[model samples]
Target: MKHCGKGVFLRPMSCDIKGVENLSVGDGTLIPKGCTFYCTRAELRIGKKVIFGPKPTIITGDHRIDIVGKHIIDVTDAEKLPDQDAPVVIEDGCWIGANVTILKGVTIGKGSVIAAGAVVTRSCDPYSIIGGIPAKLIKMRFTPEQIKEHEKILNER
Candidate 1:
């Protein structure tokens, strides 16, 4: 919650955010209840006008596995075995459906639609319709010609 822009609505007592200062939400974004964002070691950025449905989890860090002789959970020294982390970016005008899990180092492209219950493990192209366990491109939201027209109309507004 470092840079919350105007008209953003983050419901109280519903969403969980660790490392609050490492996150930023852009203008007009609506984060519904039951969202969890962990930004312990990297930035988590959500661009303008983005909508996130309930129970969406965005993680920027993972448990340390490189520490020898101890399980990832059993590592006691924080300085010796730091968690691996990376930035997660969700670009403008995207729709992230409920129960979605967005992992570290993923940049969801502008205006993309992530289907519910999908696990986004990689980046997607702009305006794509993405779904499945390891989210894949189902289709583009519009044809190339339509996209041009849409962008023109949007710019005009």
Candidate 2:
């Protein structure tokens, strides 16, 4: 891990992380068992107070499949395949549900809840309740009035 703030906890023995130095976790984030961060080409920033359900996967890159006349696994410098790499940012207070797959360059906004088995392919807004493969906005988690109150409470904490 590149940086970890207060109260960050992960079951490292049960997790499969490729780029440990590219993983930075903020205060009070609780990452559960069997989670994966495959960030060999880019970094991951998990914000404060985020919670993860079982077996979530965050990837910052994908294998190059466009190499002419060459298989993906046979690409030269396979570890540093730089063509499709980008950083992933999960903002503060997100609740990532079980079996979620968040792809590279996606920024999950503050206080969002990602539903179980969702595959997030794009960025989402704050307080969103997102679900489904190539996840879409199911709803906002709170009324605008309530969200203001929520932020106030979070700031106090």
Candidate of highest lDDT: 2
Clash count for each candidate, listed in order shown = 0, 0
lDDT tens digits, residue span 17-120, model 1: 89999999999999998999998678999999999888999998777667668786786436433436789999999999999999998999989999999999
lDDT of 2 by residue, 1-157 (tens): 7999999998899999889999999999999999988986689999999999999999998777777888778875554566578899999999999999999889999999999999999999999999998899999999999999999997897
- Compute the lDDT of residue 75 as modeled in candidate 1: 61
Clashing pairs in 2: none
TM-scores of all candidate predictions against the true structure: 0.92, 0.93
Clashes of 2: 0
Give residue 126's lDDT in candidate 1 (0 to 100): 90
